[model samples]
Target: MRYDIPIWKKSNLTLDEAAAYTGVGVCKLREMSNDEDCEFVLWIGSKRLLKRKKLDEYIEDMYSI
Candidate 1:
């Protein structure tokens, strides 16, 4: 058996993956995730994960960030 996670099928994404998926810079994604007001960040220990669907909703709602 084999399992593969295509980007669109993921519920969470690493900064690198998020950058590739959204065309956002890794530094910028990190910066945004660090914000106290950010709505798309998920923390697992010290690792920050971006919520894929929420991120899509955020990007869709944003004119600029």
Candidate 2:
């Protein structure tokens, strides 16, 4: 079963949207964002957003490892 969130439909996704799209926890994504190597997070003022393309690339890299 697929859960299609409206925010996930966008190119830029918030932390929650990225979590839903990746089947990963929001906390994990936040943790990744804290890593110096993870440059996929976008900061707009105090809000954080993740690029859907970057998240997809991250998932692909994880599985390819």
| Residue 35 in model 2: lDDT | 66
lDDT string for model 1 (10-44, tens) is 99999999999999999999988898788999999
lDDT of 1 at 62: 90
Best by TM-score: 1
Cand. 1 Cα-lDDT: 0.94
TM-score (C-alpha, index-matched) for candidate 1: 0.90
Query: RMSD for each model, in Å, please?
Result: 1.6, 5.4
Q: Provide the lowest-lDDT 10-residue window in model 2.
A: 56-65
Best by lDDT, which number?
1
| Tens-digit per-residue lDDT, 17-63, candidate 2 | 78878888988889888765666878888788888888788888785
TM-score of each: 0.90, 0.74
